[model samples]
Target: MRADRLVSLVLLLRRRGRLSAATLARELEVSTRTVLRDIEALSAAGVPVYAERGRHGGFALLPGFHTELTGLNHDEALALLIAGSRRGAQAFGLGSALASAMLKVVDALPESHRDIAAGAAERLLIDPEIDLLSRRVADEEVPGTIVAEVRRAVFAGHKLRIHYTAAGRPPQWRTVDPIGLVTVRDRGYLLATRSGADRTYRLSRILAAEELDEPAERPDRIDLDRAWQERSTRFRAGGDQVTVLVRLNPARQEELLDTALAVRAEEAGSDGRLRLSVTFQDSRHAEWALWQLGTDAEALTPQWLRTSLRDRAAAIAARYEPP
Candidate 1:
């Protein structure tokens, strides 16, 4: 990351002013030769880095030469750093560009506030794969080339042909009028229309993509949020959705909510636990979610679920019984 080192070198000179090559090497943790090379690179890139020849002389930027971060305050700069580092940014194939931009963002910030903003961003964590239950989150694999092609089609307003494989379905070629792209929970989706019907294709399932030269026959103006919302509404409406009544330890409530479609009703009981109605995609989904809570949750109305958990627990207990 010579580029990062170069940015650091400039920041150091901008902050401290006229530090010797040895000092820049110490701060950048690189050899003085590397520091000199970076200074040369910066100067070549029109960064106005000049070296003075004397015992006290060192590298420094021209006076009053700085890149303001568009008046971004400390918090705003911190937010940009955090957002740029999210793995979800990779969903749209912007990882490299985002990294470069974020570096530039830090580079452009006022020198006095720059270090503090960069340090603060390091303290915040977002979207780690492992949860409190130690279950690793799903990270779907998607080819960068396919995403790049799909992104081109979506932004260029061109037709896209994709060899898409829907779950439990064979890969089939679909030509879609690209509308927009959306990334939810680290999964990328292309929102398009086929013959005027809405179609959403997951990026991971796209085995191949070809951007057609023909322009997309999509609405000139679209409310992407509204379109995605309608599709989500339809998807939830069409599923074998089931609502379950359950009681769970308040501490485990988040775990249940993570697996649920939505919370229909909730009540905090006298026992300091939650009694609630929650929806899942189906009965199996509801049963599986409750079972994960072990004794921390109880299925109140779903008798079959209770029986299922009871039978599962009994079988486990029986296996551990003494001979």
Candidate 2:
């Protein structure tokens, strides 16, 4: 917080050229004495900051003082601003504060570059759905206080006392050593290790969570990045692993080959139809794929799948016919 207040003071001086101690204090919500001490600290750190004592005089950054902002291209800057706006500006924790800090960076840019940045921001509109999905999962629906406390516990390596209610189960209290938080498909999950278990719980299922004062040693083996990668790989690998054989018309064969779901293809008979071998995650996904090909495609192997598809089709047909 002190570091944030220091940065804020620097940006304020950079923007307004001169601000009184009282004004800086009011803006930063600190006392005038605190503002003066912060200015002294900034000057001590070789920031070229100074103050004047008199009516209508105040603290100001010396002329020609500039800080370099790195790694941001035109598109990146626009994208960053657009993302901040979509995060509701205030709900992104430090992101909102960082967004405000970006304004000073924009102010420091040359007029031509500034106009380019502004134009890009206005022309490149990020869709709301994509923006919403990009936010921190904990911030999506949970109260700010809970999100903050959980984050604190995770960072401090503290244990959490939580009341969780799984689907089809009664709510019960459990003590978990908070490992980390993960966002999967826009859902927030607490990657905690419970007593005698190795898996984590989704935080949304938690009816109540409170941080404990006791700290625990951080686990060296709990790599979040690796866990995320493994989860994605396993999910993709686990989808119906059955080898499906389908006969398709020539035109339908071309369509099927163009799709990501098509795993393999081969000529079926002299009639010029094709036998496609595909690995699908589930019968439902395969059925959907077959439906997209309409009458041109027919399942050839896995009799159970074919029978199931037929029964489903018959049931669907029965719903529409005259009783």
lDDT of 1 by residue, 242-288 (tens): 88899889999888988888888999999998999988888888888
lDDT of 1 at 72: 58
Each model's RMSD to truth, in Å? 12.8, 13.7
Q: What lDDT is reached at residue 270 by model 2? A: 75
Any runs in candidate 1 off by more than 4 Å, and if so which?
1-85, 106-137, 268-273
By TM-score, the best candidate is 1
**For model 2, the run of ten residues with the poorest summed lDDT:** 86-95
Cα lDDT of model 2 by residue, 68-157, tens digit: 466555433543654545443333233444555577678877899899999988887643443455863344455556656676788779
| Candidate 2: stretches off by over 4 Å | 1-116, 130-140, 220-222, 231-302
Cα deviation in Å at residue 258, candidate 2? 14
Q: Residue 126 lDDT in model 2?
A: 45
lDDT of each model, Cα atoms only? Answer: 0.84, 0.72
lDDT: worst 10-residue window of model 1? 73-82
